[model samples]
Target chain A: MPIIAAQGLTMRFPRVTALDRLDVSVEAGVVGLVGANGAGKSTLIKILLGLLPPTEGRASVLGLDIAREGAAIRERVGFMPEYDCLPPDVSATEFVVHMARMCGLPPPAARERAADVLRHVGLYEERYRPIGGYSTGMKQKVKLAQALVHDPQLVFLDEPTNGLDPAGRDEMLALIRRIGSEFGISVLVTSHLLGELERVCDHVVIIDGGKLLRSQAVESFTAVSGVLTVEVQDGRDALGEHLHAQGVAVRPEGRVLVVDIAGERTYDLIRDGVADLGLHLVRLEQRRHHIEDVFTS
Target chain B: MSTSTIHDIGYRRYDGPRLGRGYLVRSLYVHNVRAVWGLGRPARAKVMPFLLAAVMVAPAFMDVGAVLLTDRAEVLMRYSAYAIYLQVVVSIFVASQAPVLASRELRFHVVPLYFSRPIAPLPFVLAKFAAMVTALLTMTAVPVVVLYVGGLIAKVPHPLTHLREFLLALVGCALFALVIGALGMAVAVLTPRRGFGVAAVIAVFLLSSAVVLLVQNIAEFRTNFSLAGNAGYFAPFNLVDIVQVRLLGAERTAEAVPDGFISGVLALLLCAALVGGAVAVLYRRFRKAGLS
Candidate 1:
């Protein structure tokens, strides 16, 4: 069953409608919510978390109604917010342990679980240091640690890679992927950058202007489009002309030629054309569709 | 010849039973209580509360010494008048620490983290309210306890009377804590900035008292009968004092409100109103703040 299901959920802020009748059901996996800023990604997550009541329609997380069962749902789900929400005065261990206790762990269990989760999130001795003295990456790790300390069945990571350098982003993404794959924990991770989600998400949901643009498995999302990218060793200009002469829609994209796939014969035509011109065909492959293509196409 | 691998401390799911909502409230209460006194915070955070508490307790010790040295009961400050006497220190305590309890969460945007858990917004707010009240109670009651013990240690005559008065002073202290705590928390929630919250809490007390005193003095000088006695109602501290004097049967020292059964009822009603109004404001503020 889908872990989170929303039916025409709409959230109207004072000035803008953050979610406009957004209907999407997220299955249990590493699901990526891809959208631009103000594209209703955070709004949908807030509604699912029962933090904000939707202006219209209904939603559910873990099969529990968001309106009536928010507390119960929150008991089972964890959230790592996009912005900083930790107390700088407290140490990471103290904060996470407190969060674990807030999630209903007894004192000793809370402390033990906090330590384990902090370790999982790659925080070491610095976990005892005040968060005020830590780097942004360390603070983010603490936020992640607190979210996971409760051992929630599902986790909502909102821009988890935000404010991180490249290596930090990679580490965070790897951690998120492991959370889904190894631990069997459902993850609904949001990012504006499509490439990051493409690496970790089993499924991708693209949103734009507070509306669902596309939702599909990650494999289907990057499935081959009806276009082939052809790269020749030399005479790239000649290759474009040759493909054009064959009544094919072809355009030069840098060192390669992008040809519209007319049918199965398009591949054969490209092959025969390459032979006819005596030019070395360095690469010929079906162009993979990107999540950004959902918006552009 | 040794094969020792690094301990694999990767992610592990907690299948342990989750406790109920009461735990959330209790944990928040404990955390906020510690936060109020800066127990787990930096040493610098400890200075203001401890300093004020020490200053408050020192007077009681000195009062006992004076009683001992002079062999007179006149040196003893009245039990019920303790809060009124140390009103400035108490107000500073409230003003300085209420923000730590009420405003710091909002300032750091950590409120959303709390609401995202099983904890509801009302309980979260109530926990903060309870913590501030406890902190205020400690600040007020510790000195009262000191005075009571010192009075007994000095062997003041009518020991039973001193104990009874001490008990009554504790009741008065509780009322003071509730009223001041409510007002401080209500003011602190208006802004997320600690400095602004502190300034606003102080202004609510000091400004109201200053205005009421100015008005009272003017009315007395100008022979305005209506404003002379009733002006004390304008300040929360003075209103609390009026309650301590009339309803609690404590002797009126500073406030000049006329003594009557109706005055006692009015003071009680106003105390209830202040507390109720503060809770109402906080509930409304937190309803919006839960998501903010």
Candidate 2:
């Protein structure tokens, strides 16, 4: 069964419709919801977290209705918001312990869990200091620690790499992947960077303008599209004309011949045709469809 | 040294008993109450609340000392009038700390963190309200207790009478705490910036009182005691004193006194209206802000 399923979920603001009829289903893995800034990624996460009610349609998480079981859903789901929400006056230990306690852990157990999560997030020796004194990387770790201290079944991390430097972004992505694979917790992480998601996410869901453009496994997203780009040291136009004469769809893209694989013997035909024309083959590689192709194609 | 083996302490799911929503609400209440006194905060954060508390109790202690030194029990202040007597300190406290309680979460955008948990928006608002009311209650009631004990130790006549007045003063303290806490929190929640929130709350208290006092002075010049007396309802401090005098049978001070029991009833109704109106406004405010 899917961990989360939305059916025609729509959320409308006064001046804008943040989410419009969004339909998605997510299984247990590190699923990346990829979108630009105003693409309703946060709105969908908020709806799934039961923080905002949709203007129309229904949504469910863990087989529970979002509208009716909002409290129950929140009880089992943890959320690391996109913006900075930590209280600056309190130490990380105090804040995480307080969050743990809010999640229904008793005082002693809350403190123990807080310490454990802080350590797990690689925050040591600095956990006792006030959060306001810490750097941005440290603050993001604190936010992640508080989200995990309660040991939720599923966690929604909104832009976990937001406001992080390159190194910090790498570390945060690694931590998110570990939470999904090692911890066996279902994660719904959102990011606009498709390259990073390709490295960490098992599945990617792309949304644009409050609509789901594509949702598939990460492997399928990067699979070869059967289009091969062939480059010759000499006579690139001659190669394209030869492939075209042989009833193959060929076009010249800059200094190379972009050949569509017409049949089962397309690769052999290309090699034979290049040799027959006495043209040296500089490069012949099959091109895979990029995740960015969803926008242009 | 033996090699340390890697322990696979992967994230463990919380299968232990999940407490109910009541626990979340109670935790918020405790957290906000501690925040009001600057507990678990920097030393500078602790200064204002503690200094105000000390300033509040010092007068009671000095009243006790003067009674002891001169052997005059009449110098001891009345317990029921403590809220009226220390109105400025209480106002300052409400102005400063209510922003700490009410606006800090909104200013820092931490309110969504709370609502995203197992708690509802109304409970979140209620918890803060309850915490502010409790903190204000402690501030007002503690000084009244000090005065009661001081008066008793100074050996004023009728100890039972003093106890009765002490109980009545506690009731007045509760009313003061509710009205002031509600008003301060309501004002503070309107503005997210702490400086603006603080200034707004102080203006609500001082400006409203000054306006009422000025109107009453004008009414007194015209010998209109009814109009001057009824003007007390516009001032929160005097309104509480009027309740104490009429409903609890405390002595009326030299300031505005109600014309009759009906006027006192009207003042009490207005107090109720103010508290209810503030709570209603706060409920809507938090509910809307939580969504946003």
Candidate 3:
């Protein structure tokens, strides 16, 4: 069953409509909610979490009605907000343990889980220091640790990779992947960076200006295109000319030659042409579509 | 020659019992109580509250010392009038700590994290209110208890009568805590910045008392004692003093308190109103902050 299902959800603010008739359903793996700024990604998460009431329509989380059973849904789900919400005065261990108790864990369980999750997030010795002294990367890890300390079946992580450097971003993405696969927890993560989500998400839901633009599996969004990319050590012009002479549509893009696959003959044509020119072949592979191509197309 | 391999312990799900809403409220209340006294915080945070508390309790020790030196029971300070004599210290304690309890979460954007849990706004606000009231009660009641113990140790006359008055004063301390705590929280929550919150709370307490005293003195100069008595309603400390003197039969501390049983009932009702109104305002404030 889908973990989250919404039907004709509409949210209207005074001067603007944040979400308009958004109907989307998400199954339990690592799902990504992709949207630009002001595209209502946070609004949709709030609605699902039952923190905000929709102007119209209905939704359910984990088969509980969001409008009526919000408290129950919240009891079972955890949320990590995008903004900086940690108090500067307390250590990470203290804050996460307090948050764990807020989720109704007993005292001993709260302390134990706080330690376990902090370790999992790669914060060992630094977890004892005050949160104010932490870097942006460390603070984000603390926020994530607090969310997971409650041991919820699913978690909503909003822009978890925000304000992270390249290495930190990669580590966070890898952590998110492990949360879904290794930890056996369903995750609904939101991000505006399409490429980053493409690397981690199994399904990507794209929204634009508070409306659903596209929702599908990442594989479908980036399926193999009918083009072959041929890269050689030298004589790129020679490869393009030879492929065109064999009645195959070919174009040179940067150092590589893009050839339109006509049939099985396309591969043989490129191999014979490269050998004839005595050029060293470096790469030969089928080109695949990217998530960015969905917008450009 | 080691043959044992390392075991990979992955994430473990919590299948244990998850307590209900009452546990969450209790945890929040305990946390806020600790915050008010700066417990579980840095050493610097503990200085203000402890210093003010020592200042609050010092006079009780001095009064007891005087009784022992003079060897006269009548020289002891009145038990019921303890909080009023130390009113400024109590006000400072409330002013400094109210911001820690009411506005710290709002200023740091932590309210949304709590609301996203299973708890609702009413329970959250009530827990905070209860914590503040508890802190204030402890602050005000400790000195009164000290004075009573010192009275016993000093061997003052009419010890049984002293016990009765001590019990009555304990009731007064509770009323003082409730009324002043509610007003301070109401004022502090309106200003999210801690410095502004502290200033605003102190301003409310000082300005209201000053204005009420000015009005009462002017009315007394004109021989309008009734009007002077009614003016006590404007200040939180005097407002509860009226309830104490008229209803609880304690000695009057303020310049004038409204006369008769009806006036006492009205004062109690106003105290109740202040508490209820503060809770309502806090609920709205936190709910809005959560959404933001």
Candidate 4:
């Protein structure tokens, strides 16, 4: 069963319609929410967390009805907000431990679990320091620690890579990937950068202007074989003519000639063509697409 | 589900302060305290109450010498510190106390953080009010002690009666602190900007006093109809002052339930109303800002 499912979910802000009749479902594993700013990613997560009431929709997280069972859903699920909220005065250990206790962990257990989660989030050395003194990266780790201290079944990370430098961003992304793969925790992570999500997410949910543009496995995003890219050093026009004469689909793409391999034997024909033209084939490979490629067409 | 995983810390289903089967109130309260402590300025955390103590004591020391000069210096000694001088101290002390309690939070933008935690907005408001009151008590108690000892060194009248009055003064100070602190906190809650909070507090205090002063002049020069005659008696905080004054049976200047008590009562009622209204406003604001 899908761990999270939404059908025709629409979220309306005062001057904006955040999510427009969007439908999405994720069974388990890490799913990435990718979109530009104002793309309704945060709205969807807030609604799921029971923080915001949707304007129009039906949704569920872990089989709990979002509208009626929000408290229950929130109780079982964890969320990491995008902003810098950690009070600079208190230590991470104290804050996370308190959160664990609030989540209903008894005193002793709250303390122990708080310690474990802080270490897990890579704040072991600075757990006792006031959050005010933490680097941005450390603060992000504290936010994550609080979410995980109670051991929720699923976690929602909103723009987790935001505001980090390249190196910090890479480390955060790696840690996120491990959360899903190593700890076996289900994650719903949002990011505007499709390439970053492509690396860590099992499923990718693309949204644009508060609408579901696409939703599919990560493989569907990176896999494409419909268009063929061919390179030739000489007789590029003749090669195109020959390919057209032979009824193979062909188009000129700048210096290289792009073709549609009409049959399985087209590779052999292309090789022969290359030999006939005495053109050294610089490179020949199936065209693999990036997530950005889908954005174009 | 009742059993624990090997990696589990093995906590039994928490039956310990069932804060409730599922009420979100307790969670909100827990979250606010956690967030406050988590922000981690321990020195400031401790300093707030300590500074509040200073504000409460500052004014009472001015009265200590006069009390020691009197024939009833013992009465001044025992009563001056906590009760008799408490109103005088707090009336002026609240000027600074109101801003620190209300405005500082506004300056920090920690309001959204408080609202967004897994807690209700009301608890955040309540905890802040509580913190301020605790600070007030600390600031007031020390002056009461100093005046009591100062009066003893120059004993004149019944020392034991002074002690009884001092105890009453403590009660008076506590109630006074609650009403004023609640009012200040409510003003802070209304505006997320510290400057606005401070301005609101000063405006409310100054306006209330101005209105009372206008009424006093009307009663003295133009109309014999005192606010006492018009029913707009300007004494809300008088009850605390009443007990403090009443303890001095001989030295008392006016009735315990004077216009100030009426004014104090109105202030208290205004505080309660403000807390309710502010919480409702904050609930809407928090939801809109995505705090919860």
Candidate whose TM-score is highest: 3
- Which model scores highest in DockQ? 3
Give lDDT tens digits, candidate 3, residues B115-139: 8899999999999999999988988
lDDT by residue (B102-133, candidate 1, tens digit) is: 77877788888888898877888888899999
For model 3, how many clashes? Answer: 0
In candidate 1, which residue ranges exceed 4 Å CA deviation? A13-15, A239-250, A259-282, B1-7, B217-227
lDDT of 1 by residue, A82-124 (tens): 9989889989988999999999999999999988888778888
- Comparison by lDDT, 1 against 3, better one: 3
TM-scores for the candidates: 0.93, 0.91, 0.97, 0.76
Arrange candidates, best TM-score first: 3, 1, 2, 4
- Tens-digit per-residue lDDT, A173-199, candidate 2: 888888888778888889888888888
Q: Per-residue CA lDDT of candidate 4, range A1-297, in tens?
A: 898999999988789999999999887999998888889888888888776778998999999888888757766777787766565556888778766765666668778788777666666567888777888888888888777776777889988887888977887888788778766679999988888998999999899999998889999889977767888777788888887887788889888888876667778778888887777888777787788876887
RMSD of each: 3.0, 3.3, 2.3, 6.3
User: Alpha carbon lDDT of residue A119, candidate 1?
Assistant: 78
Query: DockQ of all candidates, in order?
Result: 0.52, 0.48, 0.57, 0.20
Give candidate 3's error at residue A23 in angstroms.
Answer: 1.9
Q: Considering only N, C-alpha and C atoms within 3 Å, which residue pairs clash in candidate 3? A: none
* Native contact fraction, candidates in order: 0.78, 0.67, 0.73, 0.13
lDDT of 2: 0.86
After superposition, candidate 3 runs with Cα above 4 Å error: B1-7
Q: Relative to the unseen true structure, what is the C-alpha lDDT of residue B17 in candidate 1, on a scale of 0 to 100?
A: 76
Candidate 4 DockQ category?
incorrect
